[model samples]
Target: MDGQLMAFTGVAAGMVAMPGADFAVVVRNALDTRKAGVATAFGVAGGLLVHTALAVAGLAAVLVAVPVVFETVQLLGGAYLLYLGAGALIAVARHRSAATAPSAGARGEVPGPRPTVRLGTAQYLRQGFFTNALNPKAPVLFLSLLPQFVPAGQPALPRTLLLATIVVGMAAVWFPAVALLVDRLGVWLRRPRVSRALEATTGVLLTALGGVLLAELVLT
Candidate 1:
């Protein structure tokens, strides 16, 4: 149990820091609107809760039953990570361009469809719920990787819930800090060259993570 907890914590920590669809969406929403940042974060986290539950229930079993499918998931996850990393890099590059800079708008003015029109307290709640729910990786991650931590013949539900809770809670804590940090470092982060570099680095990390996951699947 101790080992499981520690491992889960490490994974959770990594996930919280890593940029994903959830991270991008939440950060965009938070930065774009008033107090919507909190709402967005919560929305993403809420989505995680649903994913966690489904993963713990029977999804993990399905993955374990068909190892090939599991491998496919790992490959797909890696690809997804790469895609996100590339997107961030592209955003950074585009923002750097003189043509795009004016259109980038001040601080929060990237023109597009806003995540929400309501902008009420409820909007925040809904944002948290939907962002997490819609994220496919959240469930796949829990189902694919978490079972490795379970002990043989042990009832998995309790452990799964615990792991999921840790992940979600950690995300709740870490992502807000991220929002603040990103917001604080807005100028530096938004700097086209710097943003591009960071995005590239993150992209590399994602690809590496994918490689690692694939390797693990192969070894098993």
Candidate 2:
């Protein structure tokens, strides 16, 4: 393995490990079910592949140079994040209210489990894909950051694909691990209070991140 490739791998790993939208999406879905979590990870991998393809084809660089395009994407991304966060927060509120409100119960009648709106695999996949794909940061990062690691005197296209693929490979491994790890904690997470807390926190994190992203784009 080339020394430069090793360094790139390290940096790419760090980037993938960062707690961004992808991380949020994985954790959010993982809380629901392991299948949801794994599907989300796969979707995130798909999103990364899209970015790599764009970077390899020089579309990433082109988008970077075109500020309007990047800005538009960022706005949409921010809006989407805000929507996700808002939805989660709303769910939390509804859950809390439902918990607190007293309903007439028959004497000695057992209560059934509250109905949950389980999102299908396709929905989870799309959620995960959009969470990562909308950011526009990938193209920018690939354009600026990937080149620094590409070895000189090598075919740039192939080298770019190789490095980009490494990032994708890392993402593929890391996110599913994250999903599974969170799934392991399902025992405690199954508790309503704990679940609601997790939901609320993630909701705020996503909302704030989206607001900040949008604010930055608008203010700058």
Candidate 3:
């Protein structure tokens, strides 16, 4: 059991370290505000809890068994990603336009307004939650990975929960560390040009991931 626990921890750590949609979202939010980033991290952890519960209850197996159900979830998740990506791009465009637009002065001179980006706590949290939860892959991953560590004839639920807790705990630790690290660089990232670039890059990556999911559904 100890060996299995160690193995699971190592694997989970690797997964947490890998940059994925969750990482992208967290970094993006963190670049904007440390609080937003931290909130997003917690939201991602919340999503993991949901996935863990589904796996423990064996509901994830049903998703795998029913192609239609799985495909539907994939489509919804893909659409959500697309929406977020497109919204980000649109926001950037709007910001740019606003920045360039002429502003009236007392002497009839015009000046550009400073660009700004703000996301409420609930919004960022929701974004993080959905980004992680909607992936469909997360639940599947838990379903696949957790079983390997469970001893034969042992109660699966307790073991699964224990393993899932480890995974979530790792994410909680890793993501906030990332947020803090990024926060250290916040001064430079807050610059208009750098901020816009980061936003665009994150948006593109998210959109691309969404496209891949949708393509997989179509092809498979």
Q: Best lDDT goes to which candidate?
A: 2
The local distance difference test score of model 1 is 0.62
Choose the strongest candidate by TM-score. Answer: 2
Tens digits of lDDT, candidate 2, 1-220: 9899988889999999999778988998898899999999989999998898888888887788888998998999899999999998998888777665556242443333332568999999999898889877788888788789877888898898898889999999999999999989988875778888888888999999899889999997
Worst lDDT run of 10 residues, candidate 1, spans 109-118
The per-residue C-alpha lDDT of model 1 at residue 129 equals: 64
Query: What TM-score do all the candidates reach, one by one?
Result: 0.57, 0.93, 0.89
For candidate 1, write residues 1-220 as lDDT tens digits: 5876797788778877776556665565444453666667776677677777778787656765676766676666555545545554565455446434554556555443212234676766675565456443466677887788777888888877788888789877776666676667666654545545555555555445555655665687
Off by over 4 Å in 3: 99-114
Q: For candidate 3, lDDT tens digit of each residue in 1-220? A: 5888999889999987899888888988898789999989888888888888889899999988899988998998899888878877787787666556566333465433325468799988998888988987987898998999998898988998898899889888888888887889988876767777888888898898999999999999
RMSD of each: 7.4, 2.2, 3.0
Q: Cα RMSD (Å) between model 3 and the true structure?
A: 3.0
Give per-candidate clash totals.
7, 0, 0
Model 1: residues >4 Å from true position, as ranges?
59-118, 183-220
Candidate 3, overall lDDT? 0.84
